[model samples]
Target: MNPIDTLNLDFRALSTFLAVLDEGSVSRAAVRLGVTQSAVSHTLERLRQALGDPLFVKSGRGIVPTRYALQAGPHVRQILDDLQSLSAGPPFSPATAEFTFTIAANDYQRDLLLPGLVKTLRREAPGISLQVIPSGIPSAEMLRKDACDLIVSPHAPEATDIMQRGLMADRNVVFYDPDYRKPPENLADFLKSDHISLVFGTGERPSFEISLNARGLTRRNVVTVSNFSGLPEFLRGTDMLATAPQLMSKHLLRDFAWVPLPFELKPFTLLMLWHRRNQNDPAHKWLRNQVNAVAAAMNKLNP
Candidate 1:
């Protein structure tokens, strides 16, 4: 058969074709589309004439799509989805939105910030859902591929497709148990004190220790842990000092005393990252607003 001009095709014929393929019969397709069976048959006939192929073939008790229809199913579905997105105008109402919002976050940021987000979701977005997944350097790929709605980390993504904004920044300080250790007031005291070293991701040494090692600085690492939350448990009632961001240390300040580090270290900034595709989505906008509000509250207390 010769190729027909697609410009002459009516858009309704595509919808009708999909409806028949889904329902498997003109009668059922008519009911599903709230149209008369004759109207459905007429639409199918027009599709057959335009495409020059029988989209479906009758079987024993139902219809089966031809190879052409089977191949076109995915493209048709994508077109339909794009059209629906373009025409979608419902206002994003968080209170009534029953959606699962997934995010990629490491244990440190997850523990520190998500609890507050969960509380806010419960109070303001009663029907919303949350899922927190472990994150790494490749989290930017996950965002671009739509694996998660957002990612939070101290490190920013290198991918240009991913956009990140600083949620908060904090300085590093020494936290030590008062019962067994005095706050390090000078460089000599800091180097002599036993310390807890935290190792995360692919780094051989933590950033604070890395900066120290660059200038021939060193500290006695008596204990090593992968997570920041465990520092309090390991250092409680002991003289070991651990370096942590000021924001992280705030929660443990009651159990441990934090004093300014003797050496200068760059302040770490926590960032929230998302794909550019979601920048204008109303639902995503609302979700960002909610998270920003939570961060603002945290900033107030830490400040």
Candidate 2:
């Protein structure tokens, strides 16, 4: 297609094309675009003509993009995003802006960070809203796809497209019910006892287990639980001992007796992660700063 002809395509046509590609059906795209299916069809026709390609073809009750459309989708999305950013003015204005940000973090993070963040938001950017979700181990693909606005993970994923900033370093501690009698005197003895492990994506907990092995011990019989918040309850009145981040244990298991890990495991660094797409977004930058501030405050309180 001629460059001038491509320049003549309207934003509506590009938007329709993107919606169809995203939704895989005209009806669904119409619903997302808040228009009739016929309108979406008409817009698709326009896009097809402007691009000088069929763009998409019907396949098995749905539409599949032609190779040309497949190649164009990302470019179109990027262009649209750039245009939207240009029209929206600055990425952030503390005094007069409304933004809903979604973050993925674990229970420990919520306990340690949310209170300070809430206070900061109220004082600085009251118009912004936050939604916190439990984060798992870092996945670069998820970040790139914008599945999450921000991810607070124990360690940063090795992805060039993602930006990572260290938030805080937290120690890990071992905990058992206060009333329980048996306390392991050493790493070898600790290995003999049943263990309750908090597991996340791709078995990240084993890194800590390896530290134990290095000390001439390993967790033999283990029970895995999904959420860190539930570990205390699971350990209460049970013989199983659990290992968790010290900051989280201090906040959640205040009433429960806890002790340091029998073996020395390296302190885990909490980090903030975001996609390259938000690199220059003013609001995103502000939110990242708020998160870092919260982490810093928590570190001081704990230290």
Candidate 3:
């Protein structure tokens, strides 16, 4: 379409296009949009003339998006999301704000960063509350579906609409009970010893394990747990080694002794992730800033 034709397009037309695209029928879309079927037809006719695409085609007893409509869906959604953010109005005030922010995080991140964040929120925004859920190898859908407002994870799923910021970097370390076993002395010793590791709810192994596998190495996983909280209990009496992020030493794994890994593996960055739709929201921006500040403080103390 030419620029002049595009100028004729407006938010109402775009919104109607989305409604039809999502609901799959003009009647259904009209119902969802609280408009009559003729109104939807009129808007779609304008959209068709402007965009020069039929957008949707009849398929079986229902409607299906044409190639052009499928391609335009994400862009349309993004535009509408951006426009909605403009209505957020005024800066956020934490002191009097009373609302809860939900975050998705595994036990490791929940322990390492959130407690500090909670303390800060309590002091500065006492009226604000937080609810946290486990993030098992986070996916973009979690943010897209609004399952959580934020995610704290070492694994960031790749997607254009998802945004991430580095919280901290941590290296793999070996944790074991000093009374039950001595540290691995070499790569061979590490391989020979029985191991305990974390397997997320999705049955995906941790990045450290993936790195080891890439190098044609494997460990004898004598025990596997769903979350970091289960590690110490299994490692306490057994002569087993648990390789995990070094920063965990300050919290969850503190009761157990940890040492640098016997071999080198690149460090991984823990990240905070959110959907692009929330990018410009004033309250969300303030919450993100608080998370960053908490991570910064942790990095300074740990470093």
Per-residue error at 149 for model 3, in Å?
0.4
Winner by lDDT: 3
Per-residue lDDT of candidate 3, residues 243-273 (tens digit) = 8888888988888898888777889899999
Report the Cα lDDT for candidate 3: 0.87
Segments of candidate 1 deviating more than 4 angstroms:
1-89
Per-candidate RMSD vs. true structure?
12.7, 7.0, 5.5
For model 3 the local lDDT of residue 289 reads: 97
Clashes of each: 0, 0, 0
Question: Which one wins by TM-score: 1 or 2?
Answer: 1
**TM per prediction:** 0.69, 0.67, 0.78
- Indicate the residue-level lDDT of 127 in model 3: 94
**Lowest lDDT 10-mer window, candidate 3?**
1-10
Looking at model 2, the pairs that clash are: none
Q: Is candidate 2 or candidate 3 better by TM-score?
A: 3
